[model samples]
Target: MDNLVIAATERSPAVDFDFAAGVLSLKGESYPEDASTVFGPIFAALEGFLGVAECRALRFDFELIYFNSSSAKALMNMFQLMDKAAARGVTIEVNWFFAREDETMKEFGEDFSEDLEHVTFNLATTQN
Candidate 1:
């Protein structure tokens, strides 16, 4: 499938999905007025990709600075899907990046990682 790239906006993150490389990344703040409008297509493409992914491994990087509750929910759902894909024998790795000074974001990443199984989740920090 073709790559998916969405430029970042004031209220949304940038999405870069390299399907051929099996790598995806989302960066910036996420508090879109309509989370569905921003995430629906991504969810669809992700589901379709995961459904028939033949790649040996997939990597997803989430470098979000701030996100509202709806974005959190969307991310949890995405994580669930990734976990399910891992259960299906696809190797999945998730790198959740937070600023070193942002304890809240660090905790959020920890909370999200708690329920994951099969998918390898890592929490990385940035100097910013």
Candidate 2:
């Protein structure tokens, strides 16, 4: 599957979805005017990648500096999809990175990590 690589902008984050390398990364701030429009293609690409992939290990990295409530909902959906994929026997690892001073982002990661059973959630604090 072709990878999805979108440069970060003021209203959106950078998305680097690599199927061959088994690494998916979403980084930067996200507060788009239309959350569904911004995330629809991303979720579509992720679903397509998972459908044809035989890779046993999937690694996802999320490094969001800021996001609105709508984007948060979209992120939850993304995690849910990954959780389902993991439950289907795919080995998944999710690394959630937040700024050292961002307690809200850390809490968000913790909340998402709760329902995940088959995936390993790693919370990391970064300077940037």
Candidate 3:
């Protein structure tokens, strides 16, 4: 599958999902006016990547300065999809990055970890 790489903007985060390397990364703020428009293609690409290979290891790194409720919902959906992939015996690892003082993001990571059985979720704090 082709890599999904999108530059970051003021209202949207950067998306660097490499299907070949099995590494997915999202960074920056995500409060776009149309959350669906920003995330729909990403979800589609992820589904396509996972559909082809069932045993590949997937590593996801998410670092968001700010995200609206709609974007949060989209992220939850992505986590669910990853969880399903993990259930199929795909090794998955999710690294959630947040500012050192941002407790909300840490809690958000914890909440998403509930649905994942084989996926290893790590909450990391950055100095930014």
**lDDT winner:** 1
lDDT of 3 by residue, 20-126 (tens): 88999999999999999999998899888877768889899999888989999999889888888888988889999999989888888888888778779998998
lDDT string for model 1 (1-128, tens) is 87899999999999999998999999999999999999998898899889889556999999999999999999999999999989889999999999999999999999999999989999999879
Local distance difference test, each candidate: 0.93, 0.91, 0.89
* TM-score per candidate: 0.97, 0.95, 0.95
TM-score for candidate 1: 0.97
Best-matching candidate per TM-score: 1
* Deviation of model 3 at 88, angstroms: 0.5
Candidate 3 — which residues are off by over 4 angstroms? none
Cα lDDT for residue 3, model 1?
Answer: 88
Query: By the TM-score metric, which is better: model 1 or model 2?
Result: 1
Please provide, for model 2 over 1-128, each residue's C-alpha lDDT reduced to its tens digit, 9 standing for 90 to 100.
78899999998999999888999999999999999989999999988877766547899999999999999999888888888888887889999999898899999999999978878999999976
| Candidate 3 positional error at 50, Å | 1.0
User: Could you list the CA RMSD of all candidates, in the order they appear?
Assistant: 0.8, 1.0, 0.9
